[model samples]
Target: MRGGGSKNSPLETLGENANLEISGDLISSSTTEKIFEVSTNLGNKIRLAHSSTSNGKVLKEHGYIYNVDAITGLKSITVAFEGELKLTTWYDDILNGQSVNLINNETSKLSGSDCAWFRIEALKETKIDSIKIEYTCDAKDGSFAYTSFDDLGNLDREGAKNKNVTVSLGERNFEQFEYAYDGVEANKYNQKAFVLGNTKLNKYNASVPNVGEYKFTFLNGIIKGGADVKNPDNTNNSHVFMLLPNHSDVVFENVIFDSTVSFHNEFYTNTWAYLNSLTFKNCTFNGGIFDFPAKELTITDCTFNKYINDNGQNDSNPIWVRSGAGQKGEVSLNKVTFTNNTVNAYRPVKFERLGINNNHFELTFLDNTFNMSTFNDTDLKNYGIYLDSGVTYHSFTLIDDGNVINGGNGDKVYAFNGVVDGNFPTKMGTKILDRNGNEKVIVGGKWKSIEEAKLCSSIDEVATDTNINVSSSGTAIDAIKSSFTGDNATKQSTTISLPSGNFSLKDETDRPSLKDKTVVFIGSGVNSTTYLANKSATGTEKGSDYSFDGAKLVVFKDMKISLGTANYNGFVRPQNLVFDNCLIEGMGHYWGDKTTFNNCKFSLSGADYNIYLYSGVDFTFKNCEFNSPTNRFMNAYREETSTEPIKVNITNCKFIGAEDTASAPNAKPVVNIKKYINPIWQITIKNSSLEGALNKEKGFYQAEEGSKGFVSIDGNVVWEAE
Candidate 1:
């Protein structure tokens, strides 16, 4: 999608050259003969194969040689390069190629005048016959970087076995030799479609928003590394698609993630910890996934499928819970689809508690389907809904018909009330009807109530049955906040009793105290106007680009935001905050901090760029829609300094940019790349749709002319017109 020309005449934008035009299908390079003979005096004696003794003179330039075997009449070779490499061969090598009978660990010696080589035996047989290798020279810093023909999706040859490749850069290491075979003729042996490294995005003039009604409805675009934009919104703004916070609350609705959503390991310590609220509505998470870790989480009307991995086995359950070191919160799934991928193993969900505070579990698998064959007998030992806390108010609702709870490892399902067992045919398969033929509260699925199984159990007996409380909080807490500085707050974590009714941040004076905050919204449903400023507040610049490294805030929402006033600027400034179904748009001032937006829409205006980004922040967008500006989208840019840049990310989203925008002059069409020295913009865009006109249009020309830097676009659709 980054190159020029049609599929037949793609621009040969090789790593060796910044931009190169190619008319023919193949690009060739002449062989370089060694200046020195077999003498060891040339540089250092380099080992040819895996032999301990150095067999050939090591040339200063890093490369390799291919030789044919003399005995077996086979050609085999291996290469080690100083930088990135590109390898390709004729179509015949892969398609209808002859399969070789090379055994595992077998080696073939080369036979040429002073040419020493050995056939690197593959673990499995392959039909590959020919190969072309293109590599770059390493820099002086001992870091080897390379981009290959494989990245271009031009391998064209299906290998019987995967290639063994290794890359070393200073203390960093990369070892990828084999990839899964897609089974498709064009994609066989190429397990991974592409690899992104430290990419970035920069834009200008983000849209703004309105007031009261909160709205955030623009899907994020992921570029490798980071994305830095200069957004000055007119209203409050938050994130809308991330398992991790990206400077604002996230809203995940109608999106898909084929891979795992992780926090930027280079910048943040706790990845999935900061979340106000997370909601999954009409989305799909195929691989093992994680939402804002250690936060109030929820899922409704979504599909969570743990598809089988390449090994013909499933990864862990679809959801892996490492809830922020045991903070009290809830994880609810309603009208969701939990399908077991035929290609993988079972156990749809797993939870591990490691935090200090005990969690108040509220899990619901409503109207969901858990394919039976996925889970094995032993899976239930550590699978399904779990309450790691020894004592907590938890609920598990299986609302689907034919929902089978495999009775394995003697594990029984219990409702939050602790008496209503969550299984089929309650009361030991007895028909104990209530006032209207509904089942009785206490089924045989949970620990029994004492009192000799009497017909009329006393209140004291019911209380002592499971030693758990059953009373619900009559009223919802309007505001809750925890703000603890240093050690005192950490030591004195806030705790709210179970069944606390709907928590809401009603007005400017009413903010859930984040001071020493450990507030958990465990009630059935809660609503909060997250990141939205009060109507009376006039002088207040929207909390744009605010950083939250130590603050912990968790919230839940039954409905989503409507894309009103919210901040959208700077690198993730919030330490931990999550939003669910909250509309966040570019309306308020700029306050881009570390935050997560799950199941929210972003469709508003009032910022130079829809979202702005700065340094030291990591964010993610999951299943959110992104409708970019029709003209141009740019982030903050300084013409002089470049030390502290900006970054952001978007995944499993739908992006719609403006139509017929002109390309930025003398620069690529990326935001935050203009007016700076040594500027670095890291962003990654994957698995999304980028609808709208490309740079060839007039609108994009004006925008692209103003920026400079790297922009990596993969697995996205790019339209030529609006």
Candidate 2:
């Protein structure tokens, strides 16, 4: 006989030498339910006998009796009580197809008893059907071990929809929970729906498959590093969710996430595949990064705290879409409403679309409160939206509305080193409302209300001046070039104000024509208006006469001219011209007669010379600085045989060498004069500072053997090459 007893067992000992025990295996028939009774005394053991039949004729073998035995010999057994008997068993045996109705509210006081709670192992090979479970256990406190549920178990078929199973876990707190249906096949006809509800899960990791819709509701979870079950070697312990290819929908509502989340590749080569849509509504994410690359992503009523690192390890800004060769698709952030959110990030969003053909990318920011206060790192201080460089795709658009970014450090909205001319936000200081009725303005290095700025004049009113303001509306260079020709040509004694912007002049036909015009071109400032020439004029006849024509008297003030690869002269043969507070950079030559300069600067790095005079004329320089690091200052090359020599006068002018320091011996000569048939060049330097010494013993000019020139240096300071 086999018998088991706890301290509260009802069986009693018969005598000092006789102990009572019982053992039985309950047997059942196909048609009827059987019942058994037990009756025992203090010193006697009871056991029931199996009967073959009631008569001699064998009772038609209806059902067999239950096998019963007793440690002490007994004749008959009878019931003494009327209440039902309850059984307690281990959960692990229940998972192995044990049939027992477990008591719902039983507590095991033992510390290491398997009958305390049930556990289901989510191994690679496990299958379970309809089960009801109710427990008040904590996985973190060692009450249960196998608490996580993973759907990647080895099933027989591709679709588990036929199983029709439901696991009702009631009011349990788990340390971690995982769900992944990666290998499931797509099923549009009878797609199944899995639901996990009423659980306060500490950690979560899920990847919805293509076959069905997965809904997670009322889940308060924290997903972070070291919470994942499949931790690959030599990788960060991060939580990743991939909406696999052909996935229908994954919804997360009424969930609070207190961990970092990423939606990118599983590894370097394993991308998240393709997803139709992913939606998040009414969620609070404490700190997380989103590297989502989906067809359509919708986020509404969410709060994001701290900075989010997008793709890689370095934390600068969150990259939304970086489309490359194999990652080309029509990705979009459709109808994202953060109306009840507070965002604190360095660079909030960075979108880059390259090598994507016939695909559109769109982003929309609506009704959100942004705090541009903190940064991912100290070096990444520009806390605003960062548009990646060279983001040229088929079509891209951005819709921003009702978003307030406060405490801005740098540009509130900045694009990288590329040209982005689509619907971009205006300058930060400008008062404007975005498309979604959001007031946005940057004030005192912070984003604030437009009314707080209290500007003295409106931007439109300040822009409408009486002077002829050059517009960079269309092709900037072409616009400026067109302004100098046709009926809109600059008139005499008129002020042509250049706008405060950069202009790219590429076409040769787009060069400004200032021939015979006596106009004064005023700029916003020396560093404000920049004219960048793109075409090269090397080895061309007009190389020395590029950008301008032989105007009579033109005045240029407060502007910057940048020469391209062309060895082009910025100004050519302006009879009587003046330059005031201008910066001429990368100019190959400057050929003009009777030219006067005041408070002007020149940066001629690899030029032939800073100034070249071919004819005998009066060129005066007062308070002008020339910075020619690698070339000569002045080159007087008179080819014609004339009795009149080129005359130049420099007063209070400073000539700086290419090498800024005094210890460099690479300084060039001050003046170089070529041999002429009738050499009579004259130069006067008084009250001026020359950084490098003159070329020859004549101090200011190096004339050929037969050439002659007069260089008068009076009260001038000369610096010898170190």
Give me the candidate number with maximum lDDT: 2
Give the top-scoring candidate (TM-score).
2
Measured on C-alpha atoms, candidate 1 has an lDDT of 0.30
Angstrom error of the Cα, residue 636, model 1: value is: 5.4
lDDT of 2 by residue, 1-722 (tens): 01111111122212111111222321222222222223322222122222232232111132111222121221122211112212223322223322232222232222222333222222122111112222222222332222122432221122322221112121222234333333333511121112232111111223334434322222223333322211111113333433232333434433445544444432222233434455665555554444444455667665565554444333434324444322344433322223445566555554554325434344565666667654334544444454444443333344565566676554344334332111221111122335753332222111221111111000111111124567755344454544555676543334556778775433456466656655556666666777554344554436544444566665666667665434444555667667655676765344456676655677775555676665437777755678765536777665556566667777666777643334333434667766656656677877666664322222354555555667677744332211
Question: Candidate 1: TM-score?
Answer: 0.29
Q: What is the lDDT of residue 37 in candidate 2?
A: 26
Model 2, position 386, has a per-residue lDDT of 48
In candidate 1, where is summed lDDT lowest over 10 consecutive residues?
Answer: 456-465
lDDT score of residue 398 within candidate 2: 47
Local distance difference test, each candidate: 0.30, 0.42
Model 1 per-residue lDDT tens digits across residues 224-265:
211111111110111112212212222343345444443212
